[model samples]
Target chain A: MRRLPLYLMLSIAALMVLFPLLVMLSTSLKPLDEINHGSLFALPQDPTLAAWTKAWGGACISGTCRGLSVWFANSFAIVLPALFCSLALGALTGYALSLRTARWVDMLFAALLIGLFIPPQVTLYPMIVLVREMGLFGTLGGLVFAHTVWGLAFVTLLFRNFFLSVPRDLLKAARIDGAGFLATFWHVMLPLSLPVCAVALVLQFTYIWNDFILGLTFAGPGQQPVTVALNVLAGSQFGQQEYNVNMAATMIAALPTILVYLLSGRLFVRGIAAGAVKG
Target chain B: MQRVHLQGIAKSFGATKVLEQIDLTIEPGEFLVLLGPSGCGKSTLLNIVAGLEQPTGGRIHFGDRDVTDLEPDQRDIAMVFQSYALYPTMSVRRNMGFALKMQGLSTAEIAAKVADVAKLLQIEHLLDRKPAQLSGGQQQRVAIGRALVREPQVFLLDEPLSNLDAKLRADMRVELKRLHERGRRTTLYVTHDQVEAMTFASRIVVMDKGRVQQCDRPEVVYAKPANRFVAGFVGAPTMNFLEGELALLSDGPALRLKENLLPLPGLWASRGLQVGQKVVLGLRPEHIGLAAADDVGTCPGHVVMTEPTGPDLYVRIRLAGQEVTSRMSPGQAPSPGQKVALELDGKAASLFDVADGQRLN
Candidate 1:
């Protein structure tokens, strides 16, 4: 059939895409000796749950064997409030920008959108100093603040483009129906923006949960998130290099984001199609 | 209901003047229609009255209260937009009762008012449904019901029926008249449809180029338009104009064409016109009738085209080196190239100066 080569190409691309994930999953099940002596692609003849248990319960980091539980809680403490604050601010800012009351509003929005381009890695130094000056360094609050600031540009852009699709007549009708600014947004605009909100929440949650540099830089030792803790576990200085445990720890650290993608995939595509790409 | 007055209203957007020195008063309980083509600033004028747009320089008074600087909610005005602008997320009951709820009315009172309006509009069965679930006609009824539930000082409708189909638009026009009669609400409607303006307006204000052309009863506007633009803009099939010069016949003053002479009444010169002055003779198509061929004193012409619309025939006649249309009864319709004579009702005709478009008599 003429479709043979096309299907072959697609099958190759899919294998390439799933190859790393399969290696991680298979490697995490092997014991240390088999992982060392066997071929890289060999199936583990004797698989064990020791690495998973150790990753969940007893992986040593910072002279402690507390595993990922503490750091997972730390990430949650940093992420939940940060997600809420960033998304709330972003939705309000986007709604205001979408109103387009004056010529200068466009200029202001352009200036704000400039933040989306400059990489957060470049701004980490200034952010550290800003967090320190505010007396938030090494605290969960500091990490939350850092993540919220980083996510604001993206979430704001998404919500602004989404709200722009609503008709001007609906807003004017609300105004004439005696709704003030806040009431109009709460009763009308908010109810219509549920899909876009889901997209923003999923995206922001994954971003904040997976962030390593911001958590390691601002979180210091006591408040470090799971990503930072996993880094410490993988790069242990005194132990033999245990690739299976490192791979298992990496899988655990990435679970939330993968789950988020699976849950919000369809709505994420809809959001991108609704002008988030332009934003 | 309250009398609404817009005094010396002027609005300019970045040097593009929209409305200039518009001063009009809408009487209490009067159904006033602002009729104009697009970009003529009719909707802008309505928005200004609704307090949605601030005028560059003006004052608006609803009854005795100056509301020029007030917000739309504070102005005691309710408006229905062209799109029927119902809140998509709310049910029909909530859509109709939103203004009352915003006014902080008790739940029972809001429910009572919304129910009353829904029943009156015959939308009681649709109360639980959203706007998207309703047909265009049903959505329009709900929009009107929303405005009625507010009981505001003024009801402003901005081309509300313009989005409906032709048959539905006609039905809505009749319903709008009936609604105004039953409620006796002071209403201001804006549309470019001359048929809607002619039928639904208690008084019609014809506007063009951001200025008022004429504001009077529809019958007066139909019989005697202030200028040529009003004459041509407000009528169906359009008024016809023939260029000629004023001359004195042996009997009296008359309009002299290249091929025929049309007699003018003696009192037509009461505006101090004289012979040899160029004028345009304005004639409605319905006023021109087919005369018997070979009749004395009749202008003979040939039909160049004919279009029959079941109820009436629009026959095109080539008369005096020009093509013009005449509305005739269907039984009297003529075929193309048929010989016929044209007769004008002199008393019902109008004349305008060749230099200016102002009416002569």
Candidate 2:
């Protein structure tokens, strides 16, 4: 067919994008001696689950021999509560702001927009002092609080713009139907915002899951997330690096975000498009 | 049913006055429609009555209970929107029952009320379907059913049928009229469509530039519009306006157009018509008809165009240096360039003072 060349180019582009993952998979499956002696692109003649198992549970990470499992649990602990708290607060704030036409609401929204543009590093010192003042510094709660605070600006912006597109008459109708503010939001606005929530969820999940500096600074050693643990495992100074274990560990740390995207990719695209077009 | 009274309802946004000094009352079980062109502030007035928007100056009362500062939920009102505004995520049953449920009604009571409304609106089979699954007309009925389930003291609708197709709109109009007849609820409807206002309103409030021009029975508003604006706005193919001055003809007082003197009917003679008084002639298309061979008070003209709508023909005539339309039966429709005489009924025609646009004899 006439489209053969276009298909060929697309296949080549896909291969180029997937090549690094393929190499990581090949390197992770090979034995240590084979990896040292053979080509990087070579398939493993005798594959093993040694590196995966070691990276998951047995390898030393920052003088802790219990590998990424504890830290994986720590990441989930930080992410789940942070995600729930931030999304709940963000959606409510967005809905409330969308209903009012006062000048103060717009000024407050502008302030939130200003909050969104500042890099996390710029606020890390102040946040530390604040958290320390609250006696939450270096605790798992501190990390969750940090992530939730940083996530609110973006999540609120997303939901606020989405909520603004809803028909004003719908709100009036709800009011005339004898539904109060919270009742209308709970029954009407929340259900209508499912797509926007998905977009926020996936994005917040990725940001919180992959975070490094925040986890390193705010979390206690025992509560450090997998990103910090992965860094420690990969950069250990005493011994020769185990490339296979590091690669496998990197793969494990990145798995949840990948799966989150894969499961809800269509909805994510739709949500983004809906927000963009409507806003 | 409760009487609705809106006293001195005035609203202004910054420097722009949207409504000014609007005072009206609706008797129990009256269907009063606020009709106007776009930006006439009809919708704003309706919002103020429903307690959705606060007026800068007003007090609203429902049967002697002042509700001006009350939130919409406390006003015991229900409204149907132009877009229907149905809860898209809920089934029709839940959408209808939501308001009752909000009042802390038991499930049995809510379901009973919802079922009764659904049956009344003939949307029982659509109870389980989401709003998105239904067609436009069905969603509209569901929206109405949602309002009906509340059985509130006041029903407010803002152009509820404007979004439907012509046929569906006509059907829904009849259905809404029937529903009102059964419930006898005090209702306020806002729309820009003259036909909808004429057909559905027991009384039509004609508004322009944020002011009420005339509020009267539909038939009275149609036959004798209070001012030039009402006369021109309330009719289809819009009323034709020609500037002239009152002059004396051989038989009677007449309106003098460029070289043409239109003889006035005998009824205007006793109204103390003065000679050489300037006025604008407001003539409805239907009032200008094909003249009989020996008809008196006829203005001669030539047809410029003929528009054949299904049942009637609207002929645009070039008369006395002005273009005017004459509605005629299809069988007697004139071709372009055909010479004709149009009978202008001086008795039915509206004469407006050129200065204030107010009606004159």
Candidate 3:
């Protein structure tokens, strides 16, 4: 067939991407001795759940044998509140800016867009100083605040662009129907923003859950997230490296984000392309 | 019903002037239509009246209550947009009842009011359907029903029928006129379609280039336009124009073109015209006819083209080195390139001065 070359190229590209994930899965299922004697890409000869059990419960991380359970709980605590705060503030700000009341409003939107270009690493020092001044430098609250601030620009940009494409006459009709700002937003605009909200939710959830630098810096003792715990478990520096437990911990830490993408991947794609074309 | 009054209304967007010193009053129960071509600021004037856009310099009153500083909801007026603008997410009942619900009326009362309007609009069976599920005509009726349920003091429509097919537009026009007769609200309508204006409006305000050219009844505007723009903008198959000088012939005064003369015998529109004064003669297509072959006072030209509809024939004539069109009965249509004697009826013609395009008589 004429399409044989195309299919061959696609299969090679797909295998290249799936190889590391396959290795992680295989290594996590093998016993310690089998992993030590086998090739990195080989399948397990005798599969066991011992490595998974230790990764979830008994592995030593940061001078404790309690494993990743507490840290996994900590990630949920940080991500849920941070995601809520960022999405709410972003939606409100984007709705207000979409009204296009004056010249200064456009200038303000342009200023917010500038925030998306500067790397978060560039602002890390200023953020640390600000959080220290607020008396929340090492607490979970400070981590939530940092994540919300870093994510605000992206979420707001998504919502504002989507809301701008709404027909102006809809707003006028709502006004004539006696709906004020809050009422119109609740009854009209909010219902129409479902796809955009789904995109923001999935993205912000994955970002906060997978973040390493901010979690390692701001999380106090006994409050570190799963990513920080996974790093400490893999690089203990004192014990002989247990490669199987480390791989299992890595897989457990990544499961939430993978599940999120699977659940809402179609909506994410649709939302990204929402306002680029009109019907 | 409330009488709507606009005084000294003016609008300028940054540096571009949109409307200039527009003043008008609509009596209670009167239908006043603002008729103009696109970009002539008719819709801007309507938006100013609706309290949707504030005028740069003006005061508006609805029955002695100044509403210039008020928001649209506070002004007690309803509008039907060109797009119909029905809420996409709501059912037809909810769309019509939304304003009443905002007023904090009970659910039972809102339902009753919505039902009454739906029944009147003959959309009772579509109460549960969303706007996207309906056809264009149904959406238009729902839009009107939404406005009607509010029972506001003033009603405004901005080219509401422009998006429909020709037959649907004509049918809706009659329906809207009947609705106006029943409700008798002080309504302001804006459209570029002259037929809609002529049929629906109690008084039509003809505007061009952001200025009011003529404000009168439909027949007067059709018969005696105030200037050249109003005459050309308001007619179909467009009024034919001939630039010439007035000459006093042996029988009477006549418009003298290059090697051709059209007799202007005792025409009221040509009163006080001095001999040899430059003027433009405007004649509608139906006013020119095929004269008897041997008639003495006729201008002769060859037919350039012929367009035949069922009841009428429009023949393009090449006369005096210019092309002119004449509307005749289908039975009287001459073939192309045939010589025809044309008769001009000066009684219905309008004479405008060549210098300023203003009516001379």
Candidate 4:
């Protein structure tokens, strides 16, 4: 008898959290007329694949009907490069900061940690000017570099904490066995860092793929990621409001990060626990 | 064979000096144990030898080469940490072979060497198992195997057996000694376990407060400790100390305790004794015995406690307001709260200057 209220409360809370996603899905499948006339909670009266097809290949914007597919490819090109570079550099920097006990390195790490609190907006103009001066502004490469820099602080911090948990004696033993810095890191340290790398990859991939601000500012029209393209498709003034198509496009833009979280959710949780817990 | 020499070694953390002017030589193919309680810098000294730590001001020599600036790998040393720092991800075999593989040795050579060492250590069957999968003793063996496969010039072990159960530790002690006997590698071992030092070390370097208290053979350090610290540290149950003054008795110089005047052995009295000078008398528990009242050299006391250990007993007795233990055969036990007479073995007794804690010759 006591479980009924708790069960009802839990269901209500879960529905509240999932309401927006469900609305998006339902509206995407509804026919244009039904979507225009009915409440968000109502089931689609004339469910059809028309909206999905239009979002995938026929959504029009400023007389252009190339759907979100072009933006999806663009987002991938930017995100993949940014994610790879940031995670790689973050892991290397973390390994050095955690393992090396030099005074300068410690000071440098302290400064980097302080970088985590800096507001991204404070440096936007200078970064834009710098990117333009480097001939990378208005290109996918410029957007990737921006994302990589923004993602580095969290990735480095995560990797550093994870590396600190590793027993120092293992590294010491490897050193005594004739392993130089890179060899020890490659054979001993990197293999032990899989859990942290998984976490960093997930975090950076999600952040870069979903990023709208940097992508909107730096990415050229041909290189704009899916988030910016979705905004353009949804809020444009020239066409009749295609609610179904806009919902479908938003769902498509969110799919990769959602899929990543779904696939590796267990690992993500475990990695966070392992990296956060003190020995 | 490889000889290690540490010269003028000093280490300081900020303003605090941890190790100061430490100098010691470990002869080739010798087992030298650095024995000290925790925070005494025994492990720090071992790390210095292994090149894992850089000395603030010093030079380390492996035979003719000055390796003070060399990396740990270039110095050719292998250490077994107290925690047995085995690679958690790798199998026991791979952990052992990792160093050899890092050295760019051929796979065939690495395999053969690993096989030989594994057979000797009796861990051949555990090659496929990870460190977490193995029991404490197995993990310990794998750690030692990892060190063994390297065939480095020096083996630095920092309290390697400290993490095992008592029975396993005792068993591993014998195994480690046998391993040393077989390989005869130049080894520097560190531990707080005095028994491990007494049993394994060809020479024991007793340390206190980051200074070398005494470095001598096990028997010599046990029988004639350099000072009060060495005397108290090297023995189990430790040596009993009684504050007293040297005085002249009818026979010779004697030690005057609170209510007892224990005569010093004549041989010690002849060396030098200033009248009324403060001194401390040292006696091991085993040297004190329970004697009959009528026996000569007997001092009467009341039994405070009795601890029985199968074949032997430790009887604590109060004499002159101080408690002293006497080891006796179990058949001749003294019960608590009973009157007893204590016999002192003067030949094994030692005297120290009260101010300096230095042993009096």
Candidate 5:
């Protein structure tokens, strides 16, 4: 009796938090006519898989109807390289900065941390000009480079904090064993950093995979990532909005990141807890 | 065998100096201990010698080769850190063999060396265990074994037994001495514990505030410390100090405490001394004794406290408003608040100039 109100309040909070996702799923399954009525709480009058298939294989964009498979491939191509390059660079930078104490390195890390709070929109026009100068605009490579730069701060900061938690004695021991910088990092530091690396991978994967702005700006029509492709599908100008197809396309664009989180959730939590305790 | 020489070593971080103009030579097969209080730069000096740290200004030599600018690994030295610093991810066998493997030694040689070291350290059964799986003492032995397999020119240990419990630390101290005896390697060990220094070091370098206060054999440093700092720093329960004036007696000179006078030996009195000169008298607790109330060479005091540790008793007596401790045999333990007479062993006493804390001959 004493805990009844607390339990009821918690349940209500849980339902409130889940309400938007439930509505999205319910509306996604609804028929076009029911969706047109705009009563989001109402279930579909007739259940069908047609909307999901249309969204997965036959969404229209700019008078062209095609499945999102091409855009999914585009997202993968852009994200995988971006994630690898960013995490690799971040880990190396973190290892160097943590082990080598120098005024210049400290200044460089300070600059990188300050870069974290800089608004992406402020760099938009200049980055575009720079990308054009490098002959990378409108290419998948350009999109990867841009995402890598954008994701570097978070990854480097995470890896740096985690690496700092490692005992300095271990690093000293490796140094005394005749390990130079690269050898120490490859053999000792890197092996000990798996938990943090997993975390960096998950974070960079989700961010780059779901990114809309950089993907939209730099990725030309031939190389547009799935998020941009889905936007074109849902926001098409000259057709009756294909409600089922748009819902299915949104789900498709969201699925990879969702799957990553579900699969690596335990490691992610452990990494964060481990990093946080040391900090 | 190798001899290490550090000449005019000085190190500073920004404007703060940590070690200044340090000079020492470690002979081949000598077990040298750098003993000091924490933050006295003993470990820093050890690191400098090991090439883990480059001195701001200095030259270091190992058997005629200059290594001041060399990296730690290039210096042919192995160190056991206070934390043990065992590779947590590797098995004990791999941890011991890592240095040799890194040097591109053949697997057969690495295996043999690791096996020999492990057997010597009594850790052969733990070869398959990770550091996390082993107990503290076991981990410490593995760390030493790792250093031993390298067979470097020198071995540096920075407070290696500090993390162990009291009993384990004592036990490991004996083991470390035995290990040093067996290997006969030129070793430089850093520790803040004086007991470790006195028990294990062939030569002890007592440091304070980035400077070597005194360096000598353990017994010599214990018996005749260079100054008040060494005298106070090198003993357990510490040497008791009393400030007083030196006065010329009819036969010799004596130290005059308020309400009590302590006669000095003829040898110390032979040195020139003014009648009213301020001085400090130093006495080890064990050298002071309890005497009968009317004993000729005794001064009266009231017992302030009594601590008995099975075989011996520590009696604290209040005299002239100052507390002095005396170590007595357990058979002579005194009760708190009891009146007693304090007898000084004049020949074993030390005298220092009050102002500068320098010894008087």
Candidate 6:
């Protein structure tokens, strides 16, 4: 009886967190006419898969009728390579900073941390020029490059801090076992870094997949990710805003990040627990 | 397999020196133990020998080859750390074979060598287990097995048993001595436990405050400690010291206390002895005992406390305004506050110069 208020408070907090997702899901299932007639809290009166199907393949974006599928593939193309590059670079950089005895790493990491607080807008013009100089200004490669640089600081910080807590004696033992620089990282450090790797993957995937500004700036006309495509599909230029289709599109775009969290949620929690106390 | 030599090894972290001018050699198959309290630089010296830490100034030679600049693997040595330091993600088989694999050994040869070491260590049942799955003692055996599989020139152990409980540590200490006997590998071990140093070391190096106070056999170190620090550091229940001045007695050179005179060793020379020279009288606990009434050269003391540890009793006696402990057999246990006369074995007693704390002949 005494725990009633505590449980009530927790349930209310969870509802608050789940309320927006619930609205998006209900609206996505409802047709446009029913959505307009029914209140936001009401259950979908006549649910149909048509809006989801149209949002996936038949929705008009700007002038084109091609739906979010192409942009979904583009998202993967940009995110996969960018995720690979950033995560790989981040893990190695973090390992070197935490385990190796390079005198310059601490300063280098400090300078990189300044990048995290800088709004992406502040460096957009310089990055655009740099990408153009490399002749990849509006290419997918350019977008991947930008995302790699954008995520490097955060993932590197995560990995470096996590690896810092690993026992130094393990590294020494590896060295005495004849494993050198890269070998020690691969055999000893990397194998022991599975939990942190899940954290890095989920983090980088969500950031790169959901990014719109960088995609709009650098992904060119046809190469834009689903986020930018979702904007074009639901923007003012598309005449009337198809509210149901728009909600369905947003739901489709959010599915991957949600799926990633579900798959690695256990690991994410464990990693946070393991990584927090060490810091 | 190789005799190791260290010449004038010194180490400093920035401006603070941790070790200085250390010169020692480990004969092939010799078990040399560096024994000291924490912060005594014994572990640092072991690291220097293992090539894990470079010296500020020194030359290390393995057999006839100079290995001062070589990496640990290049120097062909193995180390067991205090934490055991088993690779957590690998199984026992993989861990023991890691160094051999690094040497590019064939699968068959690595397997054979691992099997041999596994059987020797009696850890064959644990071959499939990860380090975390085994008990502390099993992990330690696997750690030793990993060192053995490599067949390195020298084995370096840095307080490897300090992390274990008392009982397990004693068991592993016997196991380590047995392994050394079977393998005959030149090993340098570092520990703060006097019993470990005394039982396992062919030669023990007693260090204090980054300096080697004495390097000799365990019996020699215990019987004749080079300085006051060693005398105090190397024994359990510790040696007792009574401040006094060296003076010429009518019979011979003697140590003059506040109210009594204790005779020095009969073979003692008056060469370094002087009248009224300040000195410290050192007596091992076992060399003092309860005296009979009217026994000459016996000083009267009153018992303050007695501690019994099955085989013997340590009786603390108040004498000359100071507390002195004497180890007596259970049969001779005296009750607290009882008056007794204690006899000092003059022939085996040591005297130290008060100013320098160096033992005086």
Q: Could you estimate the TM-score for every candidate?
A: 0.96, 0.97, 0.96, 0.96, 0.93, 0.97
RMSD of each: 1.9, 1.7, 2.1, 2.0, 2.5, 1.7
DockQ scores of the candidates: 0.82, 0.79, 0.75, 0.77, 0.71, 0.85
**Candidate 2 structure quality by residue, lDDT tens digits, A59-165:** 99777788789899999999999999999999999998888678899889889979888999999999999999999998988888999899998888988899898
Tell how far residue B153 is off in model 5, in angstroms. 1.1
How much does each candidate deviate at the interface, measured as C-alpha RMSD after superposition? 0.7, 1.0, 0.8, 1.1, 0.8, 0.6
> What would the per-residue lDDT of candidate 1 be over residues B148-236, giving only the tens digit for each residue?
99988899999999899999999999999998898888999999999999888889999988889899999989888888889889888
Docking class of 5: medium
DockQ ranking from best candidate downward:
6, 1, 2, 4, 3, 5
**Worst 10-residue lDDT window, candidate 3 chain B:** B264-273
lDDT of 6 by residue, B1-361 (tens): 9999999999999999999999999999999999999998998998888888899998999999999999999999999999989999999999999989988999999999999999999999999999999998899899989998898889999888888899999999999999899888999999999999998999999998888999999999998888889989988899999898777766656677887776553526445566897878778899889877766666678999999998989999997788988999999988998998787777767778788999885
Superposed model 4: Cα runs more than 4 Å off: A1-6, A276-279, B248-253, B264-267, B292-294
lDDT of 1 at B346: 67
TM-score of chain A of each: 0.95, 0.95, 0.95, 0.93, 0.93, 0.95
User: Candidate 5 residues A1-279, lDDT tens each?
Assistant: 999999999999999998876777777888888888768688777878888877777766655667888788888999889998998998998888886487788788888888789978888889999889999999878888888788788788887877788999998999999888898888788888887887888878988887888988998887888888888887777758877677767877888988998888888788877772243
lDDT of 2 by residue, B1-361 (tens): 9999989989999999999999899989999999999999999999999888999998999998999999987889899999999988899999999888888999999999998888888899999999999999999999999998989899999999999999999999998998899899999999999888988788999998889999999999988889988998888889999899988877766789868887756527435657888888888898788889887777788999999998989999988889998899999988999999877777787888898998886
Residue A196, model 3: lDDT of 89
What TM-score quantifies how close candidate 1 is to the native fold?
A: 0.96
State the lDDT of candidate 3 residue by residue for A135-241, as single tens digits.
99999899999999999888888788888988999998998999999888888887788788888889899999999999988888888899999989997888688
**Candidate 3 residue lDDT tens string, B10-55:** 9999999899998898999999999999999999999888888989
Q: lDDT tens string, model 6, A200-220?
A: 899899999999999999988
Candidate 5 per-residue lDDT, tens place, B245-324, comes to 88766655677887567655443643776787888888899878876565565667899998888787888988767898
> How far is B295's C-alpha from truth in model 2 (Å)?
3.3
What's model 3's lDDT at B196? 98
- Number of clashing pairs per prediction, in order: 0, 0, 0, 0, 0, 0
Worst 10 residues of 6 chain A by lDDT: A270-279
Q: In angstroms, how far off is B254's CA in candidate 1?
A: 3.4
